[model samples]
Target: MGEERNRPTIVVVDDAAEVRALVRARLRLSDKLDVVGGAANGAEAVELVRQLRPTLVLLDVSMPVMDGLEALPLILEASPGTRVVMYSGFQEQGLAHRAMALGASAFLEKSMALDDLAEDLLAVLGADAPVAPTSPLETQHPAADDLDRSILREHLERFREVFEDAAIGMATVTLAGQIVRANRTLAALFELSVDDLVGVPFADFTAASATAVRAALADILAGRRRVVKIEHEIAGPAVPLQVRTTLAPVLDSNDRPLYLFLQMEDVTAQRGAEEELRRSEDRFRLLVETVEDYAIFMLSPEGLIESWNAGAQRTKGYTADEIIGQHFRVFYPPELQESQHPEHELVMALRDGHYEEEGWRVRKDGTQFWANVVITTVRNGDGRHVGFAKVTRDVSERRAMLQEREATSAALTAANARLQQVAEDQAHFLAVTAHELRTPVGVLGGTADTLAAHWADLEEDERDELLAGMSSSAGRLRRLLADLLTASRLQSSALQLDLAAVDVGAVVDTSVATAQRTHPGAAIIADTERDLVVQGDGQRLAQIVDNLVSNALAHGVPPVVASARRIGDEIEVAVSDAGPGVQPEMSERLFERFSTGRAAGGTGLGLYIVRQLARAHGGDATYRRPEGSEPGAFVVLLPHSPPNA
Candidate 1:
């Protein structure tokens, strides 16, 4: 218990559970240090330090939530006496310096042997406990000098075994470049026995690089370079092999160079792979440079253009010499450049591995064209981002053609819709015409049959009454037929006007009288200005008045009036009634064929015929409704003029 209390307590912290467990197990090997607790992250380590106040904290550098460097000061703040040693997998000197600057006592790599790691931790804690000796000579020799000799002999034997069994070729060469000793691996490299390789001049085997090798050896002997590495081809028994040789100086206690420690590795396969990669790159570059349809180029990581291919020159109208080394933003339009879209594209490519878009791009001559662009991040063999690969395709003509096709398609669609509407309207016209004809035809047929079958039996008054009814039905049929024929002629553009000096007032008066006879007991009147004259067809003029009066009587309240007046060079003929005028919503299409406002008892063609005939006489018809306490008027304006004058 006394010894345990005297030993320094440690807390192990790492993100990996297994790593923490391994460290705990390794630290147990040291009797001078005690593992008090464990943690998985820097935050937990900080809390553990505050609670335990251990003498030492083995903290991992990289961890989730909080890394060791961030927590180091906080841990020290929590327990000022506690020493933090940074344990990490990275061997970067910057990280080590940063950790030490942040108050870490030591930075130790995780790759160190478990025993070495334990000794390091013990050293950081300033533990005075000596390591237990492993050799049996320590027990046999108690004298200090004899014990030292035994330890030295043990070390020499271990070194000899390690040197003989090393994997790569290893040898010790004198300052004169003579091989003092060579390992089995080195002997096998030369296909000679270890005994025969000793005392041989090391430069004799390096015939291809003998002169360079001698100069490198001289540099090592003169203490110019601490380490020198060179590659040369060796003549092997089967074939020539590429070898990489490293010469590191072994210095004496006086800091002077003693001899060179040589290490060699066969790199024939690596050299072949490098050569093949170079050839493949050459082929790819040639292919890219010859492409004519697309611009392929390279950009440095900073977005500066590095390589421009032949296709790039052709598409962008700039030669390689003129564009290389410029920023890639030169290809973007002013608006996109202002928005930093070019730089944004690189950022997106680096984040998502690639970015693609189609938009306007600018050329060297300041012309703009639609182009499809793709930017891909280029990474080297180490998976480090070194630059970007950009591919651009000019598609201005194709885009223009597509837009034109879209416009044409829209026009055709609209035309087809209008045709379909017309077909539907025609069908409705036929249905309504058939319905309107059936009523009057049935009435006429019934009246004629009544007169024929009961002529002898009926009283005189009844017979006269039936005759009047038959006449009325026949007149209705005649008018309906006339309107239909007129409509058909108007639609076919075959209706011709007979120009004459027609009195608009006289026409209105005659039409009103006719309407009064047809609609007995209805109040109808015609008021017109004197001397209203126009050159037009008289019959068509009368027909227009008849249709308007008929529409008012059929669809309006009583007191229908047909009036004509002269306004400037035109005559305004108006028919109005005292009824809720044409509905505000339905008034626009009232002149359209078959648009009845869904009203019954009419063929739905009266207003349409009135407007068509009015316009045919170099005139137009419109509906006017006053705001309050007034009737709606269908007004027709016709140019008033004399024939040929």
Candidate 2:
């Protein structure tokens, strides 16, 4: 009777067998509550409570045969001191009040947690009721007697069942960090059974969170904190689990730390959701902050600036703080703002979801730039417009490049027009040259016929005169044709030279003799240095001297002087005539093709050929007045070394 009185005797009434079993199982969590009997209905509950005379009757409101509201008064009448706790799946305040009026001590919903129901029952039993003694492992205090030992065993069994059947992972770890007891939930977390988890170190399963878990345990053992809760990973065998762990020190009566009570909740899904949200924000921030080519930003629905990114700062030359909250029309040019273009863009974007345009825009420093702008409507999940996402790009450099290309194309067109005029001029010069060839040819033909037909019938002097006339005409014709051939070769770039060592003074004498024979009226004199050797094509050098002498005889007063001398490393050959020098205006262009002066019988190609051949032999040709303003002198200078050198 003493032991039975020490525990609170209770009767459980439920219609379902599973409900009675669950109530019995949960009742085992408290050793102080002893289930005396069970009834399937309220009428049976009243009989059971009266027969046992238990301290409490947990009656379900709904039952077959008789309901709890009808049996409540009978149960209380049979055992006047019994506390009747009415519980149901659904809560009705009116019914609960009626049950209370019928002598029910407490009303509770069946959906309420079993642990809360236990607490409510304990509260109704009061502090004077017998409290279960601490388990033998929990304290060093020995049991006073058999009753105390009996209470200790009951309490230990109750705690053991509660720990082993918990929904979440639970373990009791000694101060040495060894797990002395672990529930099925904790063992299942590591893919092991409860027996296999005991005696294992709890730190082994939390390799990654070892330091944090250890520090938390230390704080609890030191009595600095009652509980430490943290989220960490448990390295299970199959896959790691994200767990929210709570570590609390179970204390003895003297406040000494006994053991650690650990609760681990698998939070992998919860943490994964949080991580996904974090990465999504990070990706959005990275995309907006890293773009440099386009100015990406946001504006309020009313076209006021709202947000700015790195691209907007770099492209618009305005910092985020300076630009945000300002009207977006500040980016438009003065005329565009006056015409309400910014407002128009927003309206179009709102209507069509987007707007794009290219036009002039103003920068922060008041300079204008060409920009490609896009305004995209930003909407909420409900499809209501919230703002505009504006993107702008400066196209000033591209526009300038296109303008420069147009200018270059126009310049090329004008240059082509000038080339066409030059081509026409060349065609007309060829025609005039062809007409000049007939006179010399006709004279030579008539002179040759006269000399041949009347050789014997004519007098000696007459025959000689005809013969001389024929010879002069032939020389005239030869000079005209040679000039034409040389000009042709220069144009074609096919004139070939065979170079050798030669005495340039001898070349000068031969060229002078030929010039004198061709122009009998012009007295030609040779002034040359002896043994003045130079490297050149012998035949080409003679041609050079001959052309200079012929030019002097044709254009200047006699006598024409052909002279050669070695000056420094070069050989200078000068042919001078006593005549007015070249005109100042024509001097610069004297060596150009078709350039000429007074005499016009021969083709105007002599001076041009002279200059080209001289340059090919690594020398130059020039016409200038001698010192003291004497007659014109045509000079040719050749290197003393061989042409190869």
Candidate 3:
């Protein structure tokens, strides 16, 4: 009667048969408590606890028949004094707290200490003895008396169950990285089993993961590193596993570290799937951002700016802050609002696939710039419209430069046409002038030769008259030749003048004398001047005066007069004749090349040579009407170069 009264009854409840069997097998030999019955569901366990009147109930928190919480109130109603110890696979803090509030004695994890469970039961039973361990490895379990053999068998079985059926991957490795044990999970992952894996180095099975596994094992054993976790991918001919390996210290009784415990989690398919999606997004963004020609940015389907890029900032001159949340219509001129619909175009882009156009875009300052723009719909994987992707480029400078080039080309074409016309006109003029000049020169030369052939046979008086007439004709020929030579050289740009200071009065005197000789019947007057000086070639100055006087004699009717005078740093020389001054329309062109007063028997070159010679001396000549009651004057003006110059 005393033994039966002291004995305490305990009930074991779990959803798994293996877990119940492990508990019963380890606790059956206990002298303290009697495990009356075992149940696989919470309801059945609660009924068993009621029928047996057990002192303590070990109940599974998660069960198919009824959860521990759901069966708690009924179990207590049936046997109000019964103590409850909740059993669970998860140590969820909330579930444990709830169980305690519902009158459970304690919450224990499924893989928790059996020794602790034994102690908890004794305390609930109010035992006076020291706390007992529920583990069969306990010293009081009788098997402890044969510790060596008992521990050997218990440890081997414990290791086998833990490695084979723990759900999570588990393994034991020797100090040299050999695989002493492995679970079915590892075998399934690597296409190997316990027989093939045991006693083999971990690298043997993990041929692909050899490098990393070897390093991790070395660090744990020789380097004393523990609890190191690393991601690994093992590749093989028939099997591959992307896994996470966590290494831990498994020590002996003396507390020195021995075998390594490595746990693995397969993340191959999950991680690969995530990485592929991430890379696809990264590559698409890279392509859009790296486009050099198009300034791409994000926009709302409502046409508000969403984001800006480097190309957009460079092209549009607005930073992200200034443009973001702003409407696309800001890029249009205010005048366009009344007539154009850039906003409509944006709407069209959202409804359709995209909008493309070449037109003018306004700058921030309201200046218009030519631009090429594209606004396209940006969407997600489902093809639902998300927003707009806008690309803009400023092409104002390019278009403006193209227009300028076209205008330049047109100008060049017109200029070439003018040059061709001038060439044709020149050809026609040369032919006509050559024909006209030949007739007069040939007739005069014939006249001079006939007189020369009969000079000796003629009488003295007659010969003297004839010779005088011949001489005058020859002089005329010489004058014509000189005029032609000067004009030809000037036109050909081959005449190089030798410039020097000359006495202006002397040049005048020579020209007057020559004029008197050439026009023997006409009166020639030389006005008095003492000394007049100028800077010019002496011969060129003489030729200038001679040409002016000759021009006057040929065209003037009477009393041609020549004069020279000093006026400041210059000399003014004049030849006045009673002649037509100039034709009104011909005044500007009179000093031009091949210009003269006489049309018949004239190369139209005398006055042109006169003007050219004067200009070469850095002086000039012109025709002026006489001041008061005087003949029309042909005046030559000379400026003396400075003494140093």
TM-score of each: 0.69, 0.38, 0.38
Candidate ordering by lDDT (highest first): 1, 2, 3
Cα lDDT of candidate 1 equals 0.85
Report the C-alpha displacement of residue 236, candidate 3, in angstroms: 56
- The model with the greatest TM-score is 1
Question: Model 2 — which ten-residue stretch has the worst lDDT?
Answer: 143-152
Number of clashing pairs per prediction, in order: 0, 0, 1
Q: Is candidate 2 or candidate 3 better by TM-score?
A: 2
Kindly report which residue stretches of model 3 are placed more than 4 angstroms away from their true locations once superposed.
Answer: 1-440, 443-445, 448-466, 491-499, 555-561, 595-601, 622-635, 641-645
Candidates 2 and 3 compared: the better one by lDDT is 2
Instruction: Identify the leading candidate in terms of lDDT.
Output: 1
Give per-residue CA lDDT, model 2, range 512-581, as digits (tens).
Answer: 8877776677689999987777767888788788888878877778888899998998899999988777
On residues 1-645, what C-alpha lDDT tens digit does candidate 1 reach at each position? 453346788999988776677667656744557899999888999898999999999998878899898999999999999999998766446567678889999988765655567678778877767774443443464463343344435433544687789999999898898999889988887788989878988888886899999999888777687799989876543677789999887654365766778999888899999999999999998999999899999999999999998889889999998999999999999899999999999999999999999999999999988999999999998999999999999999999999999999999999999899889878877888788878778978897898889889999999888888878888888899998889889999999889789999999999999888878899998888777889899999999999888888988888999999988888999999988887787878889887882565566778888999999999998999855876788899999885456
Model 3 lDDT on a 0 to 1 scale: 0.73
Off by over 4 Å in 1: 1-53, 56-207, 210-222, 227-231, 237-277, 295-394, 523-527, 557-563, 566-570, 578-588, 597-604, 623-633, 640-645
